[model samples]
Target: MNVGSTSTGTDALAVLTRVSAGYGRNVPVVSGVDWALRRGEAWGVIGANGSGKTTLIRTLMGLLKPSEGECRVHRNIRFGYVKQRDGLHDLFPFTVREMVDMGRMRGRRLPSDRDDRMGQALETTGLVGIADMPVRELSGGQKQRVLIARALVSRPDVLVLDEPTNDMDVAGEQAILGLITRIRAETGCAVLMVSHLLHAVLQISEQLLIVHEGTVHTHARDEAVHKDLLSSRYGIPVTIRPGSGGGLSVEAIPGGGGGV
Candidate 1:
């Protein structure tokens, strides 16, 4: 486990030990990493742009090899990854049901229960009515739900979401975030999300992976998430105050680092 990590006594799904990940030996973006994805745990990864968040995720998912140290995923653990932005859209043109079916159709023979899995996922995501609709015409929030449904259909042990609500309006973002909570409650799968939406992430995640410079520190949410820590990572003056639904609101100061 990384420094400041809390032990919930749950089994670890994947573990990273002193990892340094990047393109090549000379281009390490993040270093000295120690983290774990534990069963039934949810972690929110946050940092400024280009500050090694993607590098870390890629390393963990085995898409990019780490230049140093080791990343181990326990045998039989499956990952369902949702990216910041997907390539599928109106121009590509696939029906919503077809899009989601791709989750279980990844070069494998169709199982007897495939339709049942698909129907359950679509219903869970509230896409039963739009199952036959063209994915190209869905709203931003609907598209996100489709992606999430696709991931869920595979029944992953770990669900990884990258900026799940990046470009939506406030209402849409909140709706998608709320949907995630509902899914977690129903499925009990572990979740790890990296998002720019700071306040919402802070409110939902039980643990925080604070990536800065070239390293990561894991902290229990209530123990270390504060304006000072976020300001240091973002290099700006920040103020955090109470917000609606008992969540904290983050504001960037216009001038410089001055207290509110």
Candidate 2:
């Protein structure tokens, strides 16, 4: 994968304008944020609790209407979304395969082709062996992978995830992160993920969007800038050290860069 170059089709994607949104009749949770998601770009949105991270994702999904600015997804664009919470209820009796197959049904009428796509998605997410497993029976990580597979089965041009690694162990987190990198390498689909895991986000994200006080404070791909902003925002003293292969390592400074 050419990490230095943006995806070839990036120019074809839509530009999100100065979008603002909030709950009904309440104050806006996000405002005056203008950003664009290019095809095959991987972006991470980081912020503290109540920082409107999930709200931003919801607005992108068209589940919430923007109260201020326009959000324009390009024509013919196809997208898949994974929410922080499992929207699927536990009482719903669906197997992993069945749930994944539903993704393909969203935009097509051909059942056979949909099934084929579902199979491919399962393979992509490494859930092929557990195709017959019940959704509720899978572990948290497995279930999250299934959700990702469900999103991929539709063959989206972009994938959006909110707090995808929220309730998982270290191994689970690593597995999901690996899957994300592999998927991007294989499919070249754009990814927009909202996560609080600063270290993990820094590892894979090509760009970072920092939201604070209902607005975007910074947007950049530089590792040093991201670490500095995160350290300041979270009150964690952060120091950047050079790593192997020209990467950077971030360490928290004792009793510094830490405060709310």
Candidate 3:
């Protein structure tokens, strides 16, 4: 759960102490997860599809009641959530600007009609030119950018992104990742990214968290990920190598290649 934290002093934005979360009255999907996310840090969470990554994220975001222990965020802290692109309805009627305006709803102190923030978000996300366009007609990358804009409009202290580059082409994916990197540098906001893009995640994340079963394994930026552990958990031969972009790249041995 630790994002861009360094050995030196930095304030924590959120902390989870022996936490567990799941649907009401059901077995917990994730348990005993203890971690802290510090301000101005970037953390990447990776795991198999059903390994409770999403559930853990929901717990951290306070969208789900923790079945055990505690999940705490700093007082008055704001969060920005960017869901997977597939979650956006293609036929939704809202225009891009109007859609981005919806982000202001979560800010209790913000004026009800904070159009300025919406406008700034569009500009920041490079959607100003198309702000008036129908959301359904936008390209996949454009749609994802709109979602990012919505999240940014609130000036959140922490940004949570789930598969932000999903359904995008290579160019689109690179563009979005680059945008996120730039945003993190500019705003100094803690970023929590959950994705299957191991290379991309490693490139920008200061810390890596790998979830297996109901537990978590944390690694610092310089620590190596255990290939055998990943292979065992995923039932495939996972390997890591240096990427062209100066970060470690992860791949599965052929019999079928996929990330957990």
Candidate 4:
């Protein structure tokens, strides 16, 4: 699942030029940001809590306008988002398949195509067997997978996920990671994911962005480089060691005054 060596396609699908954003009239969470996402690239965003990682994603997704500077996505690019929480309501009483079908209504004008896409999406996410199950009855991992399936059902050019592996066990984490790898391999869509688990991000991301003090402190494709930069920024020594199931264990030095 190491995508560090993968090359992004020629065209830049999303660009942020000196983008700064915040709610109300408050100071921006991050400022002077400049970045680009090319087609078929998988980018990882990492930072401590309240480091504006969520704000940056919101700006990119057009949920919040920049207070200063600009943010732009390709005119032809369509986005699918998977939030940290599934936000499923019990009142709706939608089946798993019906829930996934909603993604197909993004911009489609034909109901037939939407139905076909939903079916394909369920199969793609390996949820075809339980397509009729109540969403509330599924396990946490299953629910997350269904959310991803819903995102993919739109066949968007860009997919954004916020903490996609949250609330899952190790096995479930692996399953989700495997699915992301397979999806990228099959669809070649651009992906931007926010993750707290550096090991998982290292497994699948081609590019890494570290946000700090309301700005992007580092960006690179090399995991080693990212590790070094992270350690330096936090004023601590971070050592990455091999862990079970080929994951990584990050050891941080004590007495480091680095802000989380």
- The deviation in Å at residue 22 for candidate 4 is 1.3
TM-score for each prediction? 0.89, 0.84, 0.88, 0.88
User: Could you say which candidate leads in TM-score?
Assistant: 1
lDDT of each: 0.80, 0.75, 0.80, 0.77
Residue 132 accuracy (lDDT) in model 3: 91
Q: Which regions of candidate 4 deviate over 4 angstroms?
A: 1-10, 107-112, 223-227, 234-237, 255-260
- In candidate 2, the residue pairs with backbone N, CA or C atoms under 3 Å apart (3 or more residues apart, or in different chains) clash, namely 235-257, 235-258, 235-259, 236-257, 236-258, 237-253, 237-256, 237-257
Task: State, as a TM-score between 0 and 1, how close model 3 is to the true structure.
Answer: 0.88
Off by over 4 Å in 1: 1-10, 106-111, 243-246, 257-260
- Give RMSD to native, each candidate: 4.3, 5.9, 4.3, 5.4
TM-score of predicted model 1? 0.89
Error of 1 at 36 (Å): 1.2
Compared with the true structure, what per-residue lDDT tens digits does model 2 show for residues 171-228?
A: 7787887888888889899888888666566666888877777887555667435556
Model 3 misplacement above 4 A: 1-10, 232-235, 241-248, 255-260
For the record, the alpha-carbon RMSD of candidate 4 to the native fold, in angstroms, is: 5.4
Per-residue C-alpha lDDT of model 4 across residues 1-260, encoded as one tens digit per residue = 01121223448877777788878888889888888888898888887778889898888878888887767676667788888755766566679988887787755474567777887789888998999998888888888888899899888788898998877778988998889888888999988889866777777787888887787854665744445777764446665677545977555655554422
